[model samples]
Target: MSAVESSARRLPLVLRNPSFGRVWAGQLLTQAASRMFQVGAVWWLVGFAGGSHRGLDSGLFLMVSTLPAVGLAPVVARVVARHAHRTVLAGAAAAAGAVAAAAALLARAEALPMAAIYAVGLALAACQALFDPCLTTSVPELVEDADIESATGFELSTQSVAGLGGGLLGPLAVDAGGLPGVVAACAVAYLLAALLVRSARFPHATARTGGGSPSDTAPASRTLRQVLAGLPFIRRVLVCFAAANVFTTAVYVVMPLYTRGVLHSTGSTVASLEAALGVGTLVGSFTGARVPGRPVAVGSVCLIVMAAALGLPGLAAGHAVALGALCVVGWCVGVIGVRFVALFQRLVPADDKPQFFAVMQALLGATFPVASLVFGALGDHLSARTLCLVQGVGLVPVALALRWAGGRTDAEELPGSATQSPARAREAS
Candidate 1:
């Protein structure tokens, strides 16, 4: 009972750390604000336009929001790497708050043009490029190495909560608050995120060190090397992802077809599995965060199990069985995600962490969609179950390869490091 109680309290205890809590709260507010803004903006555009141009407006809005983040990623990476993580994040959030306030004012005055809306959306995406890496890189600074993995799990789970909430609450917010009210809410949220982050006390940021201070603002540059600092790390990560993503992409493409063709079910039935998957992921994240062990081994095992779970729906089983499989898959993914991110943080140098994250993001953005399209095309003639089976069975070797490489990487990283954490050493052995 005492052991169980301690495990239960780990999350709450971690959350109570003033420094980590501040950053965590800021992340929660910012992500919720982001989801609220994205959904509300899209809905507003479709409602107000109410014509053939609506489709074009919607498409352009997505492209504008997505492309700017990827395009401006290198710049954000440089700023996060060289200058100061805290400053970059807080400044970007504050700037976003200003943009949100301006949009709210314009909406209230009935003078907000579609073009202006696109511009604001693009600006907000750019802010995200700054926020994500700054937060990831600064995690090690906020807590001891022992707590980093758990800290990461809690951080990511916040996004999942916001994603689920944003979908449910976005419509309600717009209905109750109006366009102006929604935007105003975003502005307040962004401002609060900024304030929370700005007040957090980070030791590295204020340390008396040879580098002057971690918070010492250096001018960010757009140099070739700085732009490409994380290329090697990106390559390594993508190699692993490439093997795993085929299975994931297959699941997404196959889910719909399996529901209709195999289960003779409706879209609502499919949604139930997806929802279960998400809830399972949230539950898994908490567990993943608390577990202290070899990340690579843990992540690889989860991936293997998740890959196997993807094929369960293909079985001529009932809907409940399929949903159970998906839940397991989601839980596995949640665990894998936490470990993968922790490994990446441990692998990359602090100054290069943001660049590595940016490259990883860009590669993921481009890769997964194309893989889905390819898989969707395959599903035209192939049975979804067959596809799932093949990929699930095939990806196990890839997971093993990742486990091997992870061990090697840990061994290589520790020898050069000034401080070696036990997790790294254990994995290396």
Candidate 2:
């Protein structure tokens, strides 16, 4: 067996690598602070609205923040391809810190306008869009290939852990010192992330050159065409990923509505459900790495489970049932996230990683605002339970498509597959 296959069943040991450890630590701080920032900003926006249409205002604020991802994907991809991974990482973090610091100053001065808040949110979101792909592409350069899956699992877990921290601490920060305090805390966290990233040494030269020698790096138009032509598997997987995100986004929108309309509960119940999800995802991130199987196959199963989890609350109206279902959904999400990302890392060529990942991030980022708007509008006419059922049913076909695409791609990557030579297939696999 190959080293990666043999080590597949072992626990993730990537943290033992000092470089990866530093990057992971930075991720934890940055993401946690990001969540805290989101919570505080939303709260402030709600108060700023000071009307019955506060929800509309907050929603608009979030939608506008995500606009950078959709509108600037090509620009971000070019920037990532041209810059060193560490440069992108540190620069993005530092830029975000500067924006947050400026916001804190404005808030403290009691001169923060809605337009300024919106601009700050947009700038921070753009930084995140750039930082995420750079970080993902840097992992293969930091550790042994065998540890990539484990590293990805740990990375996915950071988001869950961060979400929990932000959810729990953000309100407390606001209560104690208000929006300025939370913004200042975010600035500190982001600067610390930049410091950690700047300190870590990436052993591979490719990390410095952004994955290729200057001669190998093509122009943006050629690189885009090359990714589309050479990576059919990534293309197919991205389709599945986009489809699954529709339901994922639906769940986010539906949960609050379900709590209010179906369970006759308050926002506290929504918080409990979110807590349950975070816990489940935390467990699943670790567990997924040790469960021995091909990543795509395992991820297909997780998608199936997630489909069921989305539908369960519709069938059972109890709050306990809803929480349990959401927990299952979260678990599945954790597993699928690690598995698919690992698959992408393995399949995508080094020269193409940035652009492909940039596209993936942009696709995911765009899905949230569009899907949220669609489902939020639907909530006005349809019952929350019905919307949940529709989302669940919608995902069934997506799960099947993922399985079919994965199996087909794996077959194509095997020796003697109809589409590729044995040597090329070996390299692809």
Identify the leading candidate in terms of lDDT: 2
Residue-pair clashes, model 2? 0
**Model 1: per-residue Cα lDDT over 49-106, one tens digit each:** 4454443454455556666555776576668777777787789889889999999998
TM-score winner among the candidates?
2
Candidate 2 residue runs with Cα over 4 Å from true position: 1-24, 39-56, 77-90, 108-115, 135-157, 171-181, 195-212, 216-237, 256-271, 289-304, 314-318, 338-358, 379-386, 400-429
Give the least accurate 10-residue stretch of model 1, judged by summed lDDT: 227-236
lDDT for model 1 comes to 0.68
Q: After aligning candidate 2 to the native by TM-score, how far in Å is the CA of 120 from where it should be?
A: 2.4
For candidate 1, list the clashing residue pairs, or say none.
none
| Runs of candidate 1 exceeding 4 Å displacement | 1-16, 46-48, 53-56, 144-147, 212-277, 283-358, 367-429
Worst 10 residues of 2 by lDDT: 46-55
Query: TM-scores, in order shown?
Result: 0.59, 0.71
